[model samples]
Target: MSGRIPHVIRRVGAVVGRLSVYVLIWAGLALLMATAVIRFYWGEITVGQMLLNLVSVETDGGGGPIVWIGVLAIGVLPLLLTVGIAALWQHVRRRERRRRGHDVRPRRSQWVKRTVATALVGAVVVGGTTAFATTVGIGDYIAAGNSKYDLGDYYVEPSVTGAEHRRNLVLIYLESGEATLADDQLFEKDAFAPLKEVTEAADGWQSVADLQQTQGGGWTMAGLTSTQCGVPLKGVGSAAGNGALHELGGEDSYLGGVTCLGDVLDEHGYRSVFLGGANASFAAKDVFLGSHGYSEVKDLSDWRAAGEPEQSFRDDWGLSDGRLMAHAKDEVDELHAEAERTGQPFNLTVLTLDTHEPVHVYDYCTVDTQNVVTSVFFCSMTQVAGFVDHMQEKGYLDDTAVVIVGDHLKHMSAGDAFHEQLDHHDNRTVFNRIWVPGEDGNSTLRPRVDQLNMYPTILEAAGMTLQDRAAGLGVSAFAPDVPAGSAQAMAPEAYADLLGSRSARFYAEAWAGGDAAR
Candidate 1:
């Protein structure tokens, strides 16, 4: 009976045992990982955003050690778990045979186990499929294809009009900058207070009251594109061929079809530049920036080449915020001097990294708050405040318009900080403060707006006038007019549906730079 059982296991039982178990474990894990990824990338990461990241990973390395390690664990741990599960099954069966005092382990029982395991595997796979489809909003993705409003219908060719004298631009992207962090009633303390104190309205600053991170606008690339290009960033639609993704991924351009902030600024003779502590290639940001119109792009490699010490780095993500801000001050000094000498305006865009999650505590920060994350946020704001103060001291603010904004709202992953109190909070928003030269304390922005409006707002703040005070899907918050049929003019539900839809043909042209009509 034992010999017969070995034969049965080798050919028949083995098929269901190892193969089915492996499938079940992997399928289960994949579901969990998908949920985790969504949480890590703000409240949700749409399918288009996932496709963009897939392209980004293939083109460049898959970002830092933390991201890569997570990927590796997903692939590797399943194999080990499957093997262990198989071993346990064999041991239990053998023990039962010994207890029976004969080679009488029934083949019928073995068949039953195989049948059960196979059924379980199938169930898991089907369940995972359903869950994944729901998580990514497959229904909405399909429905969007037929939606009446298309991105093309609303996209305005971004342009700066009527500014005889262009002021310099100092755009700062705060990492995971949520206005909720300012709610002292909820969290331990206000992390944004230092920066807020420096940018007070009496001190010649103005702010949009409820700056939102729009649907499909949570990730860095999406945020950057929305705020700069005045449109929500999306990947190729499912209706497009696989070759379409390949076409979009190439060095040609990111969103080449539309004229973006960089494009308009370049046309208007503003010297555009970007500075960040991470690898710009992580999301093909270099391609996006270069193709759009930025003259200079600075990332980790450039800093390394410039001889930054290895000790200054963390998580293999490059320099700490402290060091990056120091370099930023110097950069502003040089740019300010150059502008003074050449009479050309400049845009020095800066992105902070200290508050990015999987938070790290720098030596400069003292963790006084209950949550280390909040303390780090406070420290980061202090750094930004110092930079703002330096610009003030140098009299650079006299002509430069400073816009400090969150790239996106804070993500709420399982391991992330601040989600406990924030998880149920209905009114989460991004933080922002704007400083325009010679503005009175009385000037105010529209009560509610999204990142899209920042494009024209920034342009207008730098003394450029828009024809309708509008561009892309957004109208300037600094201006009161919401053009008929503009996103701002649409009903909330209707506007959301527009964002959720694929807009396949429109994005195709937009990605290829073929739709220049708007």
Candidate 2:
């Protein structure tokens, strides 16, 4: 009866073990399939590409079929070996159990019992650790918490204030113009010499932090969008989509997602221009530009007759920043005359192209990929300097409240590490600075300002009335009492609300047939 009981117990254990195996296998398969489907459809992963990435770690080099087969083999090998080892160990333990009493053990090392006891203790410790981990909701909770910031904390409600100097706004969104000092070593680096010289000489050229685009990357469209829209590129939440730009002439879509500086300027009867080096058609540019109230747009097709070469198109983009500025200078001159005739200030925009990615050509510096990307950043600064010089020569510098800033910091390139053993605090944020012409000496503003606040600053500088609370998000250098760190710029959600409210108002007005085009 004792032997029969042992056999019955062994049989029951085998059945339970097999059932657990099947259950685990099914659960794993279901989880894999669900993840695959999500990645395929909503995440926009193609069938072929999905399989390829699964089988091959990187598709950069060749070996398509073989690479995939190797991937499968490597993934499965460890599991198979583990299973085999477990089965063998179980078989040995079962023999020992059958041969001896239920409490029987195999011959082992001197410390084997102690080791097993320690492992059991370790398992208890691991179980507690796992419970704590699950309770904490570790990584995702931390990230989401960090991204959250309150507007009330930063923007205290205050009264509206008036300003002087209502000049025509000409915001030249010079592509990638980071206000950095020039370096002597690199070529193609002289672009920003004009800005450097001017800022150095002028006592009023104040600098603030760079505009941080949401993703820390360049889409050109995103940069322009953030600049004009005065919000981070992402999280436009619940905004209207005007329509497709494929059929519309010029800009086809209504840029409803962002609160635009254009609408504000347009409210003041300033005709805004959206000009750039990228094609007018690229990446919803036409719709974003048009819907955001750019009265005139000059992209690649517009520059065809400017005697720019077919190979100069090999500038691998639209027009050079230098060329774009020259064209913009001409456009500004025309708009100035027209504004004089109509008694309306012209809002000119020249989105420059030269200092963008590949940072190949600048007036002063160039960098090899082997060096740090900040080496190339120096090139962008030089280009800005040169552009500023040109603007000054053409009288675009005087009395015109100019705002030049980087769309975002340069993303560090691969294999190019900043290996200096500097103090940890010294290497914190990589955002660039904002340069407000003639507003430098104001002590009321904080030492650090962010990118999104730039829109209000421009509006305030150009003589628009802003609430003291709204102005808390920004400071007018022209204002007598500027509080240090009084305004800390918009966080992502507040920024979203700011943009959405303005954009919705624009759409609502446009729908009602009042100031829609404006």
Best by TM-score: 1
> Whole-model Cα lDDT per candidate?
0.81, 0.48
Q: Tens digit of lDDT per residue, candidate 1, span 115-202?
A: 9977877776677667667766676777777888777777787665687867999999998899999999988999999899899988
Residue 264 C-alpha lDDT in model 1? 81
Off by over 4 Å in 1: 1-43, 58-63, 83-111, 238-244, 247-250, 516-518
- Tens digits of per-residue lDDT for model 2, 174-247: 45443332333432344345455666524566554323343322334445544554343422111224331222
Which 10-residue window of candidate 1 scores lowest in summed lDDT? 57-66
